[model samples]
Target: MAGRKITKKVVKFLKLYYFFLFNIFKLNYVLNKQYKIIFLLLIPNKHNTPPTQAFKKLLNVQIVLNIYIKEHLGGVIHELFYSRNS
Candidate 1:
């Protein structure tokens, strides 16, 4: 019975983890699309100035977010597998 309870808990944890991971990926995709749209819209015409510093900052933010997501997913996977083995 105790082993069954542990199995249920592991199953629940996996479900929640996958759900969270899915949302993160979905959010990343949406954000990337938005960034592309914004980049296109910000492009200057022949008579106009280039995109502003604010857009450069936004790009930096996107890079950081991507790095963070990668690290977070790696850490989560490591913890899940490590715990399973122990």
Candidate 2:
């Protein structure tokens, strides 16, 4: 029973991973080159959620941090743009 549950989870994760990959291919024109970096960073092991939700959470945090930086740093914020691909 426990083994069956584990198998189901593995199957579900593979489905999700493939689904994201398919969407990534379909949206290639719309995706930035840095996207694969984000995707790779969220690859799961023993203690993480799937990449899809993890990437969304990362974006949310990034947005909040950008807002905070702009508010706190004022004009210097314009020079703070950093490229992840760099």
Candidate 3:
């Protein structure tokens, strides 16, 4: 139906827009760690309840762990985390 076609077009447009936004945010984060906008790419929505909120908190924890491991334990961390096997 026509509605289905319109919905597909809208979804495609949103996907492309988000891709562009992701690149901009990525460049900004790479240029300055203090920006922290990269986290926005990870956390898609804002919610204060269980499940979603807990997932967001866990993501933040993982981010901290990744940074700590990369900076403080750079040499000891596994190759899987550091570099591509190829």
Candidate 4:
């Protein structure tokens, strides 16, 4: 139980910390393409890899997609990723 509590805290901090990091990397790596292309190209790859690695690779894209999807899919954005959840 104590370990679970500590893990939750760490995950939360990592989420806030890494979100901006992913955006920065996205701007660095994901620039100048239409969101359609990005969405099509990257999401499959994101799905294939393990979560920890995919988190690093796909975090920014996920954030961007959430902007579009949250309009239609409702709470999926909240449920789709691992973040600091208590």
Candidate 5:
């Protein structure tokens, strides 16, 4: 009877150990998959190339034009409202 009890305890301990081991392996696989996805997203592909020098210059010109237009419009409105004629 004592030997039977010892065998039962060993079996139970092995079951618990294997259960935890399987779960750990599953978690590791899931984390590795997520890491691979994140790494792929972070790497710039051909479709996501950085802007070229010409594009950067064009963007700068657009920004400057936007600023100039806003300032010019503000000046025109100011003159219309605060002029000596009004």
Candidate 6:
């Protein structure tokens, strides 16, 4: 991509990725901290629900904060679906 000529479609793809992939990596960095901040999704009876189901339930109720920059913030969803193993 550096030395060769790229078509307009490829250029658009690269631009989109370049702008978005950085925030994706940053969000992964933050969400990966969930294991450390484990209390946010704590339930009284861990065994009452299956691990994956409990994780899915938490995802539905909990909001993920995404602060792209100082003034820009919103929820980043895993709401398509979520699962975790115990």
**TM value for model 2:** 0.31
Better of 4 and 5 by TM-score: 5
Q: Give the RMSD in angstroms, all C-alphas superposed, for model 4.
A: 15.5
lDDT (Cα) of model 4: 0.56
lDDT of 3 at 85: 26
Give the alpha carbon lDDT tens digit for every residue of 5-60 in model 2.
66865675566556656654454433433554665566565565666777786676
Ranking the candidates on TM-score from highest down gives 1, 5, 6, 2, 3, 4
Give the runs in model 5 whose Cα sits over 4 Å from its true position: 1-51, 84-86
In model 6, where is the ten-residue run with the lowest total lDDT? Answer: 77-86
Deviation in Å, model 1, residue 71 alpha carbon: 0.9
- For candidate 1, the 10 contiguous residues with the lowest summed lDDT are 45-54
Rank by lDDT, descending?
1, 5, 4, 3, 2, 6
lDDT of 4 by residue, 1-86 (tens): 99988787678657755665666556544442455466557655555667666455556675666565435433433444434352
Q: Top model by TM-score, which number?
A: 1
Better of 1 and 3 by lDDT: 1
For model 2, how many clashes?
0
- For model 6, residues 1-86, the per-residue Cα lDDT tens digits are 64443364456556655786788768756775673357444665656666777666555543443333312321222221122211
- Which segments of model 6 are wrong by more than 4 Å? 1-6, 39-86
Local distance difference test, each candidate: 0.76, 0.54, 0.55, 0.56, 0.58, 0.50
Candidate 5 per-residue C-alpha lDDT over 1-86 given as tens digits, one digit per residue, 9 for 90 to 100:
98986686567556655665666556556655665566456555566666474455545555665566557655754564457334
- Model 3: residues with Cα > 4 Å off, grouped in runs: 1-48, 74-86
Q: Across residues 1-86, which tens digit of lDDT does each residue of candidate 1 receive? A: 98987897788668867778878889888977787677666665554655575568667868977898779876986687668766
Query: Can you list the residue pairs that collide in candidate 5?
Result: none
TM-score per candidate: 0.47, 0.31, 0.29, 0.25, 0.37, 0.36
